[model samples]
Target: MNQEDQELQTEKKGNKVLVVGASGLIGISAIEAFLDAGWIVVGASRRKPILLSGRTLEHIKVDLLNKEDVFKTFQKYKDITHVVYAALYEKPNDLVAGWSDEEQIKINDQMLRNVIEPLIAVGAPLKHVSILQGTKAYGVHLHPINIPARESDPRDNHPNFYFDQQDYISEAGIKHGFHWTVLRPQLVTGKIAGALNILPAIGVYAAIRKEKGESFSFPGGPSFVWELADADLVGQVLLWSATSPNAADEIFNVTNGDVFEWRSVWPALAKTLDVQTGVDHSFSMAAYIEENKDVWAKVVEKYGLLNHDLNAFIGQGHAHADFAFAYGAPQGPVAFVSTIKLRQAGFFKVIDTRDALTEALQSFIDRKLLPPSIA
Candidate 1:
């Protein structure tokens, strides 16, 4: 067995964990990962996570944007030993592409303050705070990021809220005698109901295009290399970050440690959905997916899928597509982040990019969240 496998067997579990943002992609996956490892978990989100498995946790439906409500709600859970903060506040439908310097920084920073400030005030026995971040923290969203991006790279001279949250946690950790870990994962993928999974976004997009007798075409610009991180892999890493002796007070860049070009990824995605592959026809996928709303609904009904409505099945296909097809950079885009630091710190988990994507697609089909289509 691998060293990680052996370590997991002997590592600690049953610690009380508070996972905020428990309904989102990262949050839900982390909850299940912690549970599978035998942690007593309490999940807090705006609503209960849409469960696809038998496992459940104590869920608190308190909005992080509301400080008073957050304080009161967390006060009852005083025995919390660690926190995995995957909470995020984004624009309603266009989370990926939506960014405003002044407003976003202010609001997101406020939410972090709300969650931790209250916990500190209430004297919760929190030992660690692990915050979630992405390449946006490295300024990839605004421009081409550094090749083989490392954790020690200087913070992006951008107005991303990641810095705000990281800064807050850093100070709090010093003052409150706790350690903080920041995890920056690339393009997190998984099957999450009510959360946007890029694989299903690709599946539905191809399904719509194929239903029109059109081949599944690449809808964005020319191919660019991207690092894809599996949600479950990230969850496992989060657990490691919280419990590992060497993972304290560190920032790590995480990916599946593989690279893919859209040229191959698009075909792989089409094949997963069992759809016909098409040529690269560059256009605004966000707008294209928006136009196919009625058609996706028909696919849901035709296959007797779990969702009656397309929007209910896929949370933000347009945004996921828009963000995935990041093409506005002046130079060719390569947004791969180095996981060397994470590996050096003793977390050796790895995820196969194509396998992760296909499994997530198959899961949606088996659950009837998506229909089985033709390749």
Candidate 2:
């Protein structure tokens, strides 16, 4: 047999894994990677299974919000050895002020009780549990002390669902007897088959503007810094965390190991989409969306898309916009460990940020998640 065939045969010899939120961007990649490594994977999603190749995969419809459903599913796979938790409620635009504090707490608190707590209680022979988290846990609006925010940075004083969920996992994991690892990644992007990304939204907007022969502008100032990480790299980290002895009961910050000013990334994106960049106008996403309410409406109406409440979307969008442009000006290069810790533990894979972005954009085109005009 050829070397390629021999390598594939060797990889088909690993362990069994159970992946929650298998339908999400990161989860799908994790499932694929684990399967490629020769692990028997059982994926649970609220929807149908994602088609995968090369390994045995079983998909089950699971409602993580329902305790009984979660329990029943785990009971069937009680013998499974590893668990990856990637399921999460999409952060609502109104998460900041629209909902009552009590309401927000209740929804997030119950998710922990119904899902994570049960896994802990069952004490399934899980050698490790890797929980997916984001940079938002550090605080959405507050300026982080450094550009590459470290895992040790103090969390924002503001309370939110992510903080609550992190607390729940920390508390529950300690009592439940499994080694737990948390991975906090910043803005993950990659070749997702049926996923949407903030970058693509920009691409689509730029594409439409180009098709209509209109100019494009960058909203928010150009000074903000946004850190981007590849979803495939994040998946690598997840698998590494699951098996690495150093990662047990610890949290790690995952990023692309570099920070980019939005000005640079935005224009690069515009160039990739063949759209005109730098139209000499600037506004925060909030102000732009508000001022151009009619324009956004026209775009939505022309495309026959669902009308997203501009005011609300803009509120969250502006926070991201502000961070993208202004975050690192005050903070010197945010000194977070990119794969430093993981590498020390012998997991040394690295992802090229530009290539990751290009591959992701192409995947969006191939899957029709975004239009060809955008490419």
Candidate 3:
């Protein structure tokens, strides 16, 4: 066999990576992406994930917040060749005030440090570290951020765990030989149960609202343009970031390389769900979903869905709702970031937001999580 074939065969038989935050939306998608590419993946999280496929994933329950738990976990995985740190800690209150919360910094910083310190302390065979970040790094939460936010733009003068975590990794690099890369993706859509993922969130939202005979309404205030990144695509980019030499010590903004206004996207979601969309309606999903938890339970039971807890399904993911349904003050908020750095770094993969959103919504239906939209 040729050299490329030999490498493929070798990976099929032996490549391994330990993905932290394995139960999360990004972590779960990253797991599938890596496994599809022939990697033997070990998934670490606070609780074991209910995986649709584990052909190559070894799930381990780990608490990154607890130092000893973090230490003991890595001690058992000395064979990990690459580390994808997708883990994050956001307290319940920080959801609304993360831009100014102090705990957001402390906890998230420690979580990142906990993972790398343990493995590095044991001198594991780690080669590259890939960290999953989001547009929050651009300070979009505080307000409507700069249009087409570039990688070289100045910090948003806000308090964020992304900075704390990034600084931790950078500091470690000064003393360690393992190179690292950072991937900042906009709203990532994917299927991960019990986690606050956008696609499933949308599926459940539409399914519940449609059944109630309420015409689909855009929840956020004024219309504003935004971006999206598919979970699977982000996973592939994470892998590329780890292996690509140009990615080291660099932060790349990732998206589907597309943009849309919520008003325009609303109709598409309505058509996909087979619901009749109506005028824009500004309301807090946090309040709406909470008040309608019993309504969601009926839909889940009626549809034989994976989750019965509306809070777990929607309440916990309020942050994602806040982002998606955002119609913040001083005019509607628009979060636009440039992916030129990622492209310039040699990774060409992209996902069109419309198709990405539809694909994820369809996946929700295929899995019986949502009843097919009315004809």
Among all candidates shown, the one with the greatest lDDT: 1
Query: TM-score, each model?
Result: 0.92, 0.77, 0.92
* Superposed model 1: Cα runs more than 4 Å off: 1-14, 93-97, 194-196, 327-332
Question: lDDT ranking from best to worst?
Answer: 1, 3, 2
Sort the predicted structures by TM-score, highest score first.
Answer: 1, 3, 2
Q: By the TM-score metric, which is better: model 1 or model 3?
A: 1
Better of 2 and 3 by TM-score: 3
In candidate 2, what are the lDDT values of residues 55-105, reduced to their tens digit?
446887888778788887767666667778777654555433532266765
Q: Candidate 3: where are CA atoms >4 Å away?
A: 1-15, 53-56, 328-330
The best candidate in terms of TM-score: 1
- The alpha-carbon lDDT assigned to residue 26 of candidate 1 equals 85
lDDT of 1 by residue, 147-230 (tens): 888888987887778888888899999999889999999988888754556666677777788778898877776566778899
| Clashing residue pairs, backbone N/CA/C < 3 A, model 2 | 146-334, 147-334, 148-334, 223-325, 224-324, 224-325, 224-326, 225-324
Worst 10 residues of 3 by lDDT: 310-319
What's model 2's TM-score? 0.77
TM-score of 3: 0.92
